[model samples]
Target chain A: MNFAFTEDQMAFRDAVRTLLEKECPPEVVRARWEGKPTEVWASLSDMGVVGMTAPEDAGGLGMDELDLVLVLEECGRAALPEPIVEHAAVVIPALREGGGKTAQRWLPMLAAGEAVATAGLGEAPLVPDADRAALLLDDHDGCLHAVEMSACELTPLDSIDRGRPLFAAAWYAEKDTKVEADFELAFDRAALGASAQLLGLADRMISMTVEHSKEREQFGRAIGSFQAVQHRLADALLRLEFARPVVYRAAYAVARPGECAPADRSLRVSMAKAYAGDAATDAARAALQIHGAIGYSWEFDLHLFMKRAWSLAAAYGDGSFHRRRVGDWLQQREDSDA
Target chain B: MDLTYSAPEAAFRAEARAWLDANVGPFRDASSNTADGFAKLREWDRLLFDARLSAVSWPEEYGGRGASLWEWLIFEEEYWAAAAPQRNSQNGIFLLAPTLFEFGTNEQRGRILPKMASGEEVWAQGWSEPNAGSDLAGLRSRAERVVEDGRGGWRLFGQKTWCSRGAFCDRLFGLFRSDPTAERHRGLTYLMVDLRAEGVEVRPVQVLDGEEGFAEVFFDGAFVPDQDVIGEPNDGWAVAMATASSERGLTLRSPGRFLATADRLVELWRARGDRSDPAVADSVVRAWMDAQAYQLFTQQAVSVLMAGEDKKMGAEASLNKVWWSELDLSIHEAALGLLGDEAQLDSDWLRGFEFALAGPIYAGTNEIQRNVIAQRLLGLPRG
Candidate 1:
């Protein structure tokens, strides 16, 4: 019943955090809004985290979702402007599961950070970073197909989160390679990765507000001294603390699918995604309200993370989407048993 | 990161399950839905105490199985699943027992714990007063030093209100300003007093649920022997703080009870909920998932407590307090929403909602908890 992470996992997460601090600070995130290159993508690939989920057979780290979830959190904490989640969490794993020639072609490049990719999985529209991707994977009725960038007609969509540039892609279906492995698990991985990132964003938002409250003074004292500001941030912290472990448990369940109870692994994944989304969004709202006009401005770094929370809150599966499914899951399971 | 229990833990769970299955049905049927079921409830407590299942985490010397935190958590899960009964001795067993173990003299342990374990003495807290609900340090309850015929003791004076179950409790424990000259949070002493004593009056008060679960306890020169004093005479604040975490943290409201409520809500949804009503379905699922989140959080928290030199929960407990109390309310709210018009009726869900209303208000209020989290946990200024 021990739920503590191994020291190695802890150290690895710390190292990624250190690297994100150095390479993908808020300025770098700001630079993304100015058409600057996401050099952090190269830094992350050099750190071998971009392909952390690719199998050992593909010269990758062969890491578990448990191992990669923390790294994704670091990416989210940085608000790193890249497709690390879609590339590593979804596309590479989907390719590896395909176990075909397409997997052989993309595995080495993606694992070594020589190339980047993006996906539209679980029937979610708007392939992120599709314009720059060398390869694309799209989900159709729970089946994954590897698509080519050159063949797809791309239409760009502006995001409130500038780091994430989305595009509507129409690819040539006949030419794309269809992966024959399990895509349901790939969807869970996608949700897990996004959820872990949302957690990181949530933590960052509360911390920024907490630090701001300590320094920003009004009414003859630190604003944090007032119960109004303190209580709002405290409420944010409560949501994050409770949401975090559920995400970690989802990571654990994803890494060891057989160990999942009730043998319905998707429910855990959805729980993490839904809870993280709500927590992060709640934090974003609190961050904005607590920071007053400062957090509302484009100049403030708080908006960057807050916008990321708002965007990701609806991405993958929003609270409404996942909640309804889990609701149906609960009712259907009972019907089956009865 | 392993979530599966070991053989011994599983065996403990199985033993607990078997015992609950064998006893709980008769216990519930005999005790529930009666005019006055206090004796039946005490009988159930005795039944549990006799099996050493009343406080599984307590030491074997104190009538427990001496279970680990994991085993205890499993026991709680099983207990809530099958034996879900209101604990008559909860205040003593959950809230005070931890503090008692921390600061009690060996004699205190020998004298007090056995009675608490055996349900011979039900305990209630005497912290809040008419003047000091959230501002507990503002309490003016006094316990003056006394000596008569070569015997030393303390004479309690002043009032303590909102004493949960004080209407029926056999004993009460709280803090008193032993030194009148000392200001707030100083010169205080923690003491245990017998409710049956001559100088104490327990006036039953009707709570929001209209039950006599609360009492206004007035102390008028109630004599408590020196043996009843916990910790140093004027250092009661520190001692009480050590156990306040127990009241606000995982000890008092474990994930087991919420998870049980969540499962019941799902059942209610199956019986009455509509998928077309996405909002209500969403509420049910979110409540269930929140319960899972709480359970996972407890696992992480218990593991943290298992390590570290300062094993007691600090300000992080405020986070736990806020989460579970609200989660309890929400779960019951979802059930009531499923019930619709019938929610106003005298049902268990209505009763649960009323009880949960007290959660955010009691155990130092969620407002106080938030301040503690901000200042202590987040290192914000206490201006």
Candidate 2:
């Protein structure tokens, strides 16, 4: 069957691309390498992008996973230093799916762009102030612990990417503030969110490399004219394309939740994460290679992308971890068949 | 955006299924476990063709029933569901028939379509040359114009490799360089040459499966009349591309085909009493899911085209090609893994393994598909 995007979806994509082009132009992205302005985040929140997947009642856009994925891809393409994935993909969904009144009270604020939210999954040292939100939710002992009025020191990590500022926070749970019945669902949502971000990062890397190859020339021709470079770029492109549907499929599974078999969903998510992780890293490395000396320079903006690629890839679980999960899932299926 | 089939489409699916059961034989029995067991499956294609059920979407003037696109898809799904016999005239019915319909002269269609539907004239391709494989445009197959008895025609002289079923096919469709000086991809002309013509030779190349599915054809001044040309002189490149595109566009291998093989693999695992191993069962389920995904993807593509949308190919096709190719290899690899040391020796499983190895190399390499997405779809500057 035809895989062409529907007219509405295509229009939506163009709208998102145009918005990012105008608001988060390359110069703005470059300027906000260290951290974006509060007003810029506020504007995105006003535009309903931050709460794209949140329920309409919760002041969110209530877009499907596919819609959110489209926006995330544009965000990646522009290399915009915004927490769209953190707010839209993770925090908003985590709060709406029965994170309780504590979550409800803050989700709308997060959706309205009045407040900022960042997920602290797999981040070591569990810094409390890493997130600037009024509330921080963490899963421990099979219960989600929601803390209010966090007061802890936040130290920004010396990140390779000036765009994404990493923070180390000191957290105090205060009390056993258990909130959602299904913490695993939240975890899956977070994984899907991270996977979406990885998809965007990977896509951007390929775009950046393609642009560099066209403009960068050696020996009277663009390096892209050379087959060696072409083959590598082609390989990177293939990896990105292959990983794309997996990410969307995983997001689809997460959105539907119980509609899919657990093992099937888990296997797909693992495959998406594993494949996207590897592809993003590879594409970034290839981008660097194609860019050559210019890519390695600090003055050039390529390293900013390379850093984001590395950080996002390893943010959740790495490729090997997800690969083994996929393998195990396959093993289970084989046994069932036998 | 929707993936569900319409109500009428679903009802048609049920009707087609019932019809298939009443007409065709039962599914291939797993007990027929011999090496050539696939050949023993009943000829369901003939039954369908005889009933005017084959190629349902082709025009009514041809052998097809002139059904809607959705109806044709419904027919395909039901036929596969019933485990119908593989089309013995796939080369003629799928590849050549479509090409003929698109570009053939009125006389050509009237002459070839009926025989192809009835399975009387099997057709094979003769495009690949000895020195030209992937770079098909660089082929040196020469067809010089000649005047014989004051009438003009072409005398073909060349060697073609990878001509599948050429040894037994009734006709061969090929590209020949009509203008030697007209540069690559420009001087070629498409011709439908009789395989039994004088000065034509065929030599079969035995594959790893111990079957001769491919052959090399040599033509030494074999004459083809001007009427035999499918399109304009020295315009074979477009025809070739159309043929190749059709070949790629045809739905990926039917799920029923893989389901049959997967079912066999499951039975083998059971016979060995290794069903207790969860790993083995898991692999079976994964393979089943992959086959299902491919089936769904094909259905989606067909649905979109049936809805009257402009159906350009999708990246998913490439993904499907790569995934199915690897799935074949992986299933065999898993089969070998399950068989353990028994897999090392020559067995039916080993033959299956060898056959699956060629999946990636044929019908355009997966590498080429990747390059296509990178350069074309992704807007990556061509290198």
Candidate 3:
């Protein structure tokens, strides 16, 4: 019956908020648009956020995705340019779930925040943050392979989200290359992780627009006083609020997989991802529209979160892709019932 | 965080589902809007009341099990999934009961609620007037203090329109302007009037569904005792807002009903669907997902409500109202779209579509809800 977060979870979330508020402002986010985010990334890694999900035995915090998802949302709120979601949410889970063989080799280094990994679980062709990744996990032909960035033949792919660099890697499962990982689980984790980030992004954009609408007046009154503008922002807020709990519940389901039914595991993540992605994208549109000419400018900070939303919606299982998965599962469930 | 129910909650849910499964079959006679159907549904209401399932969230003294919000939600999901007859006493149960719990005198609750649960006194709302539809503050209904028939009470004079279930209900609760000199939203009193009172007229009004589901209630010197006042005199607006927030959401249009509609829509699609059109399947799937979103959203709100007093729905009620209303229509629209040419027939989906049409208009129009969200929730300026 208790669907609320633990006090510890709220405390941790607040701690992340304080750290992000201090270290990762819009300037930090802007600087990383065409540059590496080494400063904030190292700060986060030092703060033990990079390896948050790795078990404590591996020299990490050993927090569940329930905790990690909250931290990831903070990262999105700050527009922190790091591939930690790929590393912690996708790759670490894949490594841990695949069991001892892969775990024994990479757990210590990854858990110690010394290595950063970016994953491409076949949802997108490009490996996010692959240019800076200490290791890259790619799913080619349904088999996952791991390789270091220095040894891999990879080309950077331009993304709308400039801070998060995507890459197309030329690699296959050769001897000593394959990592025993469940691709399906990695895919679900990626979508769910992206969903958490999108919630933060959407929330921030709406807050930004509301602030702007208050100050930026037209005809001797704030544009927000107009019902037309007010209603659009309200609709965007509705989308975000409704999508939020679905993401949290999905994180809960993903964090404790065995307890959830098999059908719920993937279906929940897909639903979260689809709802969150749509929320973020819609927020971006309304924010841009309400912010007027300033929002369209390159200098304004809204684009930082806006482009992140636009790009994230197309990556790691887009709304349409995740919805199709949901649709497929629903049809299967219905067929069984019949 | 735990989404799974406790053992007792699960047992409660199972008991409710089994009871509904066994009892709902004989009651699916007609739309509960018609006179014949209303009577039949009242019998069902008595069955539920006798079974202690009429108002699970109400206190045990009021014929309810005094269930937790979680258990109540679980019961609602099962209740609607069984396609049970609509709650014949909803105007009392949903709209007035919460207000009574919060502001009514102990005497008011003790006298009104038990009979309400038993369907012995059906209550209808008297909020809207021809002039005060969206602008409810513009209402001109007047109630003056007086001594009539050796009773110390107020005499009501004015009209209330769009009173749902007024045609058959036994009582009405509404606002009355008590001071002529006061402006709009001022000098009003929340009063409960007996529909059987002298100088009161209730003319049945036909809804778009061709049922006398609503009425135009005219009060020309109708007497209501001081005991019927819900809150302080001239503070009716605040008390009615409590009802608006509580009634327009969690208890009124619960996720259960829409979720059930989604399930039925899916079954219809399976019975006769266009396999080749991915777009059609996408529409159906989106409708289902939206319904799930509402369910999860309600679950989240329930968690907040259980945690603290300050985290009430408030303006979030507007967000919820707009969401479920639109989702209800979308689900029905998808079901009808699947039928194509055959959709025009007088089928359940068509009737549902007609009722769904009123969703955006009732319990405060969706437009008004948007304004509430903008002004109250978002702190936007009012022009």
lDDT scores in order: 0.85, 0.68, 0.86
- Which of candidates 2 and 3 reaches a greater TM-score? 3
Which has the higher TM-score value, candidate number 1 or candidate number 2? 1
Instruction: Give the C-alpha miss distance for residue A274 in model 2, angstroms.
Output: 2.9
Worst lDDT window (10 residues) for model 2 chain B? Answer: B30-39
TM-score of chain A, every prediction, order shown:
0.96, 0.89, 0.95
- Whole-model lDDT, model 3: 0.86
Best by DockQ: 1
**Model 1, span A90-159: residue lDDT tens:** 8888888787788889899989888888988766587777766888888766677887788788998886
A best-first ranking of the candidates according to their lDDT comes to 3, 1, 2
> Best candidate per lDDT, number?
3
Give the interface RMSD of each candidate.
1.0, 5.0, 1.0
Clashes of each: 0, 23, 0
lDDT of 3 by residue, A1-338 (tens): 77778888888888888899899888887777767445777777787888888878887798888997888888888877888789999888777766655677887788877888888776557777787778888887787777777778888777788788788887656757677887777888888888989998998998888888888888999999999998999999999988988898889988887788757889999989999999999999999999989899998889899988877878887887888888788777833310
How far does residue B271 in candidate 2 sit from its true spot (Å)? 9.2
Residues B1-383 of candidate 2: C-alpha lDDT, one tens digit per residue? 44345687677677777878896665333111222332332144455667777667677777787876557656766676565655656667767776787789899999888777765666778888889877788899899999899877899998998886565567889899999999898999999888888978878786666667777899998889888898899999998777766666644354455655665565565567366566666665555445544554555566566667654355545655666677777667777878888887987678778868988887678777666655666565655
Please give the distance, in angstroms, between residue B135's alpha carbon in candidate 2 and its true position after superposition. 2.7
Task: DockQ for candidate 3, please give it.
Answer: 0.79
